[model samples]
Target: MATADTMLQTALREPARRLTLDLRAVTFFDSAAIHAVVRVAERFPGTLAVLPSRQVRRVLEISGLASQDWFDPS
Candidate 1:
C-alpha cells in the first residue's frame, strides 16, 4: 500500500496533467490518500485520470468523488 505522502511527493515532481494510476499496485488508500488526490486536482491544472480498481472506485464513489467522466470511454 502506497502512502499518501509518498504519492503526493511523486505528484509534486511529475508535471501536472492526467494521472493514470494502476490500483492493482495500491492495496490500500485511506482518507489521506483521497485527500491528496483532491488536493492535487485543486492545485494542478488539467484532469487527473485515475485508473482505479473496482474497489478503489467504490471508495471514491462513497467519498463523493466519483463522477460519470471518471471512467468515460470517450
Candidate 2:
C-alpha cells in the first residue's frame, strides 16, 4: 500500500507527466493494491492504463474492476 501511495505521491509531484503501471511481472494483485491504484487513478484525470499480468487480470476480474478503462487485460 505504501509503495502505491508513493507512486501516487510521485505522480502528484509531476502532474504533467503521464503514468503507466507495468504490472506484467506482478503475480499477485490484492485488494489493497487495487485500492491504491484506484486512489491514484482518481487523482489523475485522464486515461490511466495498466499493463496487467494474467494474475493481476484475475484479481481485477474478481474485484469486478476488470472493465475499468484503466486496466489492460493483455
Candidate 3:
C-alpha cells in the first residue's frame, strides 16, 4: 500500500488531462489504497479513470466509490 501510494503521488505530480489507472493486476487493496484513489479522483475529477479488478471493484462498490464518474469498469 505504501508503494502504491508513492507511485500514485509520483504520477499525480505530472500534469495530464486524464490519468488512467489499470488496476486489473491488483488483486487486493486496503482502505489506504482506496483513500489514495479517492484523493486522486477528488483532485482531478473526471481526469481519473480506473480499470479495477474484481476485488478492487468490490471494494469500490462497498465503499460507494464505484458510483463516481472517474471509476470506469470498462
Worst-scoring 10-residue span by lDDT in model 1: 65-74
Per-model lDDT:
0.67, 0.76, 0.85
Tell how far residue 7 is off in model 1, in angstroms: 0.5
lDDT of 2 by residue, 1-74 (tens): 54666665676676554578888988876767888788767866475878889988888888888888887776
Question: Over 4 Å off in model 3, which ranges?
Answer: none
**lDDT (Cα, 0-100) at 29 in candidate 3:** 81
TM-score of 1: 0.72
Model 3 local distance difference test score: 0.85
Better of 2 and 3 by TM-score: 3
Which residue pairs of candidate 3 clash?
Answer: none
Residue 29 in model 2: lDDT: 69
Alpha carbon deviation, residue 5, candidate 1 (Å): 0.7
Candidate 1 off by > 4 Å: 68-74
lDDT of 3 at 46: 71
What is the Å distance of residue 26 in model 1 from its true position?
2.3
**What TM-score does prediction 3 earn?**
0.89
